[model samples]
Target: MSGAARAEHRVLIIDDHVLFAESLELALSLEGYDVRRLELPEEGGSMATIRSLALRRNPRTVLLDLDLGRFGDGMNLIAPLAKAGINVVVLTASEEIGRWGGCMRLGARRVLPKSGALQQALATVRRLHQGLPVMSPDELETLLDAWARERRNHDEVRQRLDRLTPRERQVLGSLIEGRTVRMISEDSVVSEATVRTQVKSILNKLEVSSQLAAVGLAHQVGWQQGV
Candidate 1:
């Protein structure tokens, strides 16, 4: 069953490291899977690219790198890929264990450190494709605990975001886009002083001290326009 499954499985690698992606593609191909590679997409377009590729290739699994250098975090692609019915196995250089929790909650099937052996990574992908659990009992428990904590943090962040009034939310959207007080004021036909006051209110409601901090917090909770 495993051998036949391996022959039919398609794996897509989305990593910005050209050399590493090439090597992984070769390795997977040698292991009897149809493998494809794609560098990270430009900012704000990764989700669409992943959806389109998944629709075209219909890969059974995706090996994703969380860090895409200048492109941005590959974590953003997990949910969309999963929704497209592709199993995602995270291949990351990130040492922070907390990030693993986030990835798993976002629909990744497994997380493999880039420091691990290539053979082990390949085996994990195979297991996932065969509908097997990748984590041991202990690891599953740890992941559940970490996921619970992350959920709590996410809820708190959402609560803070809910404190903003409609106009303040608009100000925040402008702020995240790198718009200055004057620019936002002129564009919205509001006074500069009014923009400043709204900015202060946004900061206070978001529980951040400054505009930069507010922007950072907004990103942490996956805040975007109309969301």
Candidate 2:
């Protein structure tokens, strides 16, 4: 439980999907690897519950899914499982490269998109079983670098959004909804000049010269109008 698994060929599947997990378990079991799968618990899956299951089972490798439905983000368990010396292999339906990049950054030995994942997953597990690196140093570098670049851009967008006052954000949101300054002014029962001023302040705080640019920035960061 603390270091290596009690059994070298044992693997744990932690996906919520029943059919996929069963197919994988059957496949692995046929290949002479001991396999166990976690079903969605009575209450629902959770990071805490998944972590406890892994610790209790102490498999050499864990096959994880990101969107656990009721369980929430599976990314939360990657670091802890890796730290406990269990190899984490993320198998996800999401096609986003950012999410794949995040898996490696969080210590997943391999990440497989659910599309055509069977062969890739088997190969990864085989390498891991042999104590060989699943990803080359260069491939690992590429994924980690992509993760870093994405994180940097996300942080910048969040910082710019954080600079806006509540009123300015509401004004920006109105703009996002395609409301003109006059319309926003009428809704707020303020003068056109006042709404225009707020719009200008939003542009300044967002470091964009035009209202369109400000709106685009807000949208990029997933900002919403505050109540």
| Prediction-by-prediction clash tally | 0, 0
Off-target runs (Cα >4 Å) in candidate 2 are 1-8, 42-45, 170-227
1-227 in candidate 1: lDDT tens per residue? Answer: 45566778989888888988898899988888888987456556555665576557778888888887765788988998898888889998877666787888788888888986477778987787778888887875677678788778878988999888888898899999999999999999989999999999988887889999999988988997678
Question: Per-residue error at 144 for model 1, in Å?
Answer: 2.9
Candidate 2 lDDT over 60-121, as tens digits, reads: 89999888877788999899999999999999998767667898988899888888887888
Give the TM-score (vs. native) of candidate 1: 0.63
Misplaced by over 4 Å in model 1 are 1-18, 28-88, 93-99, 102-109, 115-119, 123-134, 188-191
Candidate 2 lDDT trough over 10 residues, lowest sum: 1-10
lDDT of 1: 0.83
lDDT of 1 at 78: 92
The lDDT, on a scale of 0 to 1, for candidate 2 is: 0.83
